[model samples]
Target: MSMDPKILAFDVFGTVVDWHGSIAAEAKRLSLPVDPNEFAAAWRNGYKPAMAKVRSGTLPWTKIDDLHRMILDDILKTFNITSLSESQIHELNLVWHRLNPWLDTVEGLTKLKSKFTIVTLSNGNLGLLADMAKNAGLPWDLILSAEVFRHYKPDPETYLGVAEIFNVLPEQVMLVAAHKDDLLSANACGLQTAFIERPLEFGPNFSRQDLHREEFTTYHAKDLMDLAAQLNCK
Candidate 1:
């Protein structure tokens, strides 16, 4: 891309952590009657539409953690599950906070930290991201969230907000994400883009068929490790 972006803003959900596996594992640990994989998929399936309500201004600014709970409640009902107590539900909702990072995430981020300022630009709330980073050992310089900008991904404000935070031009910031729409939004706002392949983001059984680089992204990486290597991070 450009010589080097001053700030590397990351999309957190699937790019950094194995959300599907993490959620599924939690479900398995709880011995939920539903299939862990399908439960994970069902929970995630509600994410976009939930965010759409906020994007369309139908709902006021809501964090992804709250959004996840709303979806989870519905999913539990849909699956005919009524065994979970209030405490159990609350604990289950915090699964996002306890997500495990990909194997390369900590080391790769450690290397990249030597060269650039790294931050999270996720739909997750600041509190949620902060807790997750601490729990997962993610070395983020800052945590930028939808809660900070009052807008979600694909919104220009969210992308430009990162530039504002670091006091840099849009082109001097790079958004590394597993989703194309996210990268496209960042690119439209003049930020550099890196597409990280997270083939099993949805779940292990489901294969991701799309892995090609799009015109919008500045870099395409197999994972955080590959991106660190490409950026010449020690």
Candidate 2:
């Protein structure tokens, strides 16, 4: 790497938190009729297409909370789950706000914070990220989101927005994410990129075959702790 990043922008959902496991646990706790794992997978599967609609102007700028509710309603019908009341459904949609962090998340972020300005770069809205940060005890210097940029990940605006906010060159910001496409997009925008491996991001039923190191990334780490070590953060 030519220059060490001053800002470490994180991709939140799967990279920092265990979304699949958290959702599945919540569903099981609620005693939903559908298989919890399958239910969680179905909900997450809708995320990209929902965002794509916004990107293509098929839907107006809708925050992730609304998008999540929309997906939840559709999946409920698909699973034939009609027992939950309106209040129950609404509360369930807020699972994103209550997601549990990966075991290494808080520690890693704390360590990294001592070295760089740590902030979120998630598609999740500000409120959602804030609530999650509070709930998970995540130590973030800032919570930036697609809602703030009005553009989702893989979009140049969202990646470059980080640099613009901090008044720095794109290469001075490193995007750390679990998804390859996200890192590739950041790399294309002249930002440093780091890939965080999350083999069980989708749940135990599914296997991610692309967890290996990729040429596009400046660093490829096993998890946030590993990333902290690689960055020499104590």
Candidate 3:
């Protein structure tokens, strides 16, 4: 396991921020007809497929904000709710930019930032991530995204792009994420991997089954704070 990675690239959704809880709360606040939890899940479920279209060349290179809007439109129809105006729909879509951070996120990232060059490696667009970091007080040296690379996670270009941006070898960078698929892809690209567990990432109704430590990852942490501790961060 490489303990001395030069750059720590983090996945924002479900790792630094509580996407499920945040989305559900916002949905409840908006008085949407569907169950808030289910709405959040449904919205998120559309993410991969929408991105797949871009990845497969079926769609042009679309930013996450645009993709999210497309998904939200479909979800609205599926939920059979017609109360929202266009402005309201746009504001609701911005919930992703206003997501709440996990309780330990700020403290953990602060600690790690003191020790390493910390940045984001999320599928979230640059503007979205910037707004989230501003809203949540996340301390980051940089906010790198799929938007910058024009490719999403699990794509080697996205992972290797971090290394290229920092002029470091892939092994000198570590991918810290809550998803195994992301870590696996980064590992395949010769980047070190750290898995952060977020069991409630899908909300209270669904428990994640893949939180176990795996051989592919150099570190397995319960949260960002745990990851900070493991890395001997102050």
Candidate 4:
């Protein structure tokens, strides 16, 4: 990389927000008749495999919203949840739109935005990402998603597409994400990668086992604030 990246594309779900806590809280509010933590874990465990079906052409190119709904239905059955009406289920599946940002998210992004374009590169659909930004006061310069590229993480297209969209080389774009799978994929496509440590992404009591540094990324930090400092952002 000859210069600092012009854009920092982030993975939103666990990277910027507390999805597990949000979902678990929502579940508890609804009186789901199951342990909220276990419910959240079961729901999240189905995420990647669900995306894999779409990525491998086994399932149609379904949006994350629909995929989430599919997983929700399966888990509802897993937990024997039969009380929710159709409308309730529909609204409940939209909980991803209301996820809460991490403690330093808004401020850190505000700081990073002072230095470079800050955007999102999540698997979440555009509407979901937009609503999350508005709800959480996430200061995104622009939003990019798998919906835009019709591809998900681990696909070279999603990583390289960010550069093409901005008219820059891949190296001039950096992907800031908590997942190594995401960073490794971006790195393989020649984009710089920054790994953010979001240890409580799954839940508050859960200990993350994959916070160690790897050679694939250009930088690693404890959170977005740490990432901003490492990047020399105010």
Better candidate number, 2 or 3, judged by lDDT: 2
lDDT of 4 by residue, 69-162 (tens): 9999999999999999999999999899999999999999999999999899999999999999999999999999999999988789999999
Model 2 TM-score is 0.99
lDDT of each: 0.93, 0.95, 0.94, 0.93
Per-candidate clash tally: 0, 0, 0, 0
TM-score of each: 0.98, 0.99, 0.99, 0.97
TM-score of 1: 0.98
Stretches of candidate 3 exceeding 4 Å from the true structure: none
| Best candidate according to lDDT | 2
Q: After aligning candidate 3 to the native by TM-score, how far in Å is the CA of 222 from where it should be?
A: 0.8
lDDT of 1 by residue, 97-213 (tens): 999999989998888889999999999998899999999999999899988999888889999999998789999999999999899889999999999999989987998877898
Clashing pairs in 3: none
lDDT of 3 by residue, 1-234 (tens): 565999999999998899999999998999888899999999999999999999999999999999999999999999998999999999999999999999999999999999999999999999999999999999899999998998988899999999999999999999999999999999999999999999889999896889899999999999998999999998
Give candidate 1's root-mean-square deviation (CA, Å): 0.9
Clashing pairs in 4: none
Q: Please report how far candidate 4 places residue 29 from its true position, in Å.
A: 0.8
How much lDDT does candidate 3 score?
0.94
